[model samples]
Target: MNHQHDHSYKLLFSEPRVVRDLLTGFVKEEWIDRLDLESLEKVSSTFVTDDLRDREGDVIWRVRFGDDWVYVYLLIEFQSTVDPFMALRIMTYVGLLYQELVKQKKLTSNNKLPPVLPIVLYNGERRWNAALNVSSLVQSVPGGLEHYRPDLPYLLLDEGAIVASEQWSIETQNVVSAIFRLEHHRNLQDAIDLIGLLVHWLQAPEQTRLRRHFALWVRRILLPSWVPENEGAEWQPLNDLNEVHNMLSERAKQWPDRWKQEGIEAGRQEGIEAGRQEGIEAGRQEGRRETARNMLERTSMDDQTIADLAELDVEQIRQLRDELQSRP
Candidate 1:
């Protein structure tokens, strides 16, 4: 995972609206409707372990569920490869979070730990095949020992798979969905269109912070990855959403023509190479036929023998022999 992408994702999810939309849009459990999204608040993800070591999570938020609170642990997995032990890692983090909550006396009124919804947000190209529960990674013990096994499952939201799913609609106007659409865009024009939508959707004064985060993500992460290095150097820093939209719109006018020209040149080169190969093959076949003809006319070899020597088929050798006999 690129560090810049990690930082950008963290910054985006830090906003309460993003977190709210993430759960509302992706998590499809019946209990999601019972929560109060208006009570969403960012929680400190840093925790001190028993060894006095400080560990920090990516993003954490707490929202009211009836009289209690549910902690949403957002773990952003940006690596291209899947982590097989991701379930164990989530278990460890959840335990640490519980310990911190106990220390801070943030438990429910009944003196119990609150529910923690562990979510893994993966952006890798490959589908996630890792075990969702920690118990799945452990070997089943003999007898009744299986009952003592630890169990912790996380909700996985794979960006590529989710966006490609039939259930996911591009018409969804959520900001997070817009981000995903931009990430999974087919071409430069598609990306430009999505960015334009984001510009319109977030134009309200209340969404200034989220809009700024989107602009920063485009400037720092998307632009460097999309534009060629030489051309990207000429692009000035994009401080606002409109700047990003304007720059992409202006540059996109030249892309279709350049892309078409490049494609034509590539096809021409491929045709030339293919023709060269065909000519070489034709020359080799002619040489073999000449050898077979010489053997048929100058020697008493049979069609099969001549064919074997010249690497030609017996039928072809016979045809050459017949043609030689008919010629004056």
Candidate 2:
């Protein structure tokens, strides 16, 4: 994946719901059942490490499991290339995390460290061949020192490896898996149905922001090229997920027919090139604007930060803020 795509994945998974869904649905429920999902809290990704090279795409969350708390360390590997030293990398990160916990005085009276569950989320197109345990990387551990080898085993969630036969058991799991499945969708219809599935998952008022963000993703990133710029008249309030699903389904079907008619009309008018250029620019702007708007509504991000994320000017972000406020 490219930087932009990697950044988007980080943004999407940063949400606590996404993290919880991924852990509870994908990972075996034995460990997941021990976790109090409601008590899941995001921990800082940054830790005081002497090596600056440790800074990478990693997300950490703390959750109460019975009487103690456990950390869920998610290593997001976006590069198509496989890292041979992935286990070593995770071992270093987990050590740093344990240090952070100790610094925060989160250990027991006996100085026992909390458990850390390291999970690698690989969305790359290539197959992952990295060693899952640090112990496997030890080249020459003496026979007697075998017990001393660091044996950190991590859970791996390779997006490409996921199949429908291993269906997610919960609503959250289904939506989380569907989001990962979005990039690998075979056709436009599949993508639309996935969006519908996401909508179906949003059952509570607290999920309002998640629903809105998903809508923005579909509008700006997914369907901008296929859907007409002005056909909607205005962004209609989506009160029902089924309604939204039907609307998008219809739009996807209309694209081929619409493109065919537009092609013939462009041949007759000889303004195809100019129209295409204008359409591209218009779509870009609309996508950025919608992205900014969604961030403002769904996140606590400030205008300047949102501007940086959406690649819009600060003034444009401010205008989007005003427009969002003015919405009924």
Candidate 3:
């Protein structure tokens, strides 16, 4: 699930190609009918910027189109737990993008930039009734009658309009349903088939890599929280979770190594001469080597980079990595 996308945002914006396709149908025909591929901006995933120090935007994407070059700012944010300050959050990026467009000079002096579309895709399973806003948090009003309004619009992904669209393909439907399932599923295994199916659909280099990346990330974070102990006799879903239940077992064998490698390098640096000479050194190196071996077995990560991230010395990483090459 290593990707250049922000998962929450990707889940919010990309999976509904059904809607985007419907929305952009006009653009596909009228605007981008003959442009070179590179000039045209597109993605089935979310891209983000930190927008730190002064303020943060964490914007997913902004694509400019045509001689008019109207910018399309696709903003999506995900809420796993809960927070109420989201309106201010959206404004932060919407403003940053406006600032950038002015700096780029791509925007005309007289013309306004395209509208910023901020969509919030929430999956915490909490009953979110109130819209998130900064003014509400502050609670300001005239002393007399109390007239205050926070101008913010939210397109909830949890709502049926986005998730249950008939225009979505079967695989897209499975992934959308699976992600929403995290709000209700008893544990990670409760939704493994959909997880695996999403991996199948989105893992390919081109198909829907971004959507897949976010889906797996959401799955991983939810994986440890719960698992079904009841063993219901008829645990039937619209689909079956047990069908790809084995992937969870396989992934279990693999991901620890990824973690081990990441931790090993950190441990190596922190280890003093004593920590290294004591039994810790053996455990650190072994932890990393085994991790590299395990990750290589399951994923397509490059060997050297994996070593660096895992904090393994090049040789140990390579050695463990090389053994995987000779495997069946």
Candidate 4:
């Protein structure tokens, strides 16, 4: 995982509202209805294991469930690769958390440990194939030894996988859903639209802090990734959600042309690799057509402007536009 991405996610999850919406929107369970989201509070993520080694969690929160507190151990996994032993890791972290609580005398009235809901939020492109329960990682033994095996299971929210499965909707009003949409947006237009929605949804006076966190994430992470380095270097850090939306809306007009130029350059490279004049011409024409198609699908630019930018004939752009309109 990128350090900046990890830190930005931690920043977002630091807000109680983000964590509340995260659980309410994504973690579908009947018990979620009983959670007192208003009672959600951030807790210390640092812990000392029995071995005297220090360990830190990504984010930790505790919320009221009836008369007891349910510890939410949120582990953010942003790497491209999946951790095979993640179940074991969750077991270790939860144990450390229990140990810390015991030392602090934070147990229940019965002097028993509180129940921890271990959750792993993964944003990797690959699907998670790890065991969700620690018992799965341990081999079963005969003579009833299997009864002694650990059975801790953590809830896994695989963002990319969920998006691919289309289980979540982008139209949902939840902040966490909006964040997921922005993270896995199909195109620049999708991101711009979602940012506009975020600006509108977070307009309340009390939501100012959460709004600024989104703005910072967009300014430092999303925009730099979407915009070309030369163009993005000229951009100043956005101060608020409104500024971020305005910046993206204003720069969106220029992106089609930039993408068209990039397509042409990529075509030239492909032609050079093919080492044939016919291949060069074919590659350039196909590139222009593809760029024109992208413009038609991703933007509302007029056919003439798209043709001018893609260096294609207006008739070709019009045909592409018709094809797009005809699609179901």
By summed lDDT, the worst window of 10 consecutive residues in model 3 runs over 231-240
Per model, state how many residue pairs clash: 0, 0, 5, 0
Cα error of candidate 4 at position 196, Å: 1.2
Model 2 pairs in collision: none
lDDT of 1 by residue, 1-328 (tens): 1333446668889998888889989899999999999999999988877888776647999999999999999998778789999999999999999988999999998999999999998888788999999999999989999999999999999888878973645567787887776766655567788899888887989988888888888776666645545676566566678788898799766643443344345545555656887755665666576666555543344677667767779999888988987998
Q: For each candidate in the order shown, give its overall lDDT on alpha carbons.
A: 0.78, 0.70, 0.47, 0.82
Determine the backbone clash count of candidate 2: 0
Best by TM-score: 4
How well is each residue in 46-121 modelled by candidate 2, as lDDT tens digits? 8867756555567888889887888889888767777889999889889888888888999854678988889988
lDDT of 3 by residue, 1-328 (tens): 2223344444434434423432343232454443332433442222234644443223234344444443344433344445566667666656666766656554654576655555555544454455555455556567843455446454445433334443534533444454554344433344554566655655555555455445345444443332222322222221222232454556544554545655566546545534656546766665566556545554444666567656677777677766765788
Q: What is the lDDT of residue 130 in candidate 1?
A: 98
Clashing pairs in 4: none
Query: What TM-score number comes out for model 3?
Result: 0.44
Cα displacement (angstroms), candidate 1, residue 312, comes to 35
RMSD of 3: 16.1
Quality of model 2 by C-alpha lDDT:
0.70
Error of 4 at 25 (Å): 1.4
The digit string of per-residue lDDT tens for model 4 on 1-328 reads: 1223446667899998889888988888999999999999999999976677876637999999888898999998777788999999999999889989999998886789988999998887678999999999999999999999999999999887777775655466688878877787776777889899989888999999989989878777677555656776565666788888988898887887778887787788778888999889988988888788767655555678778889889999888878876999
Q: Estimate each model's TM-score.
A: 0.76, 0.67, 0.44, 0.79
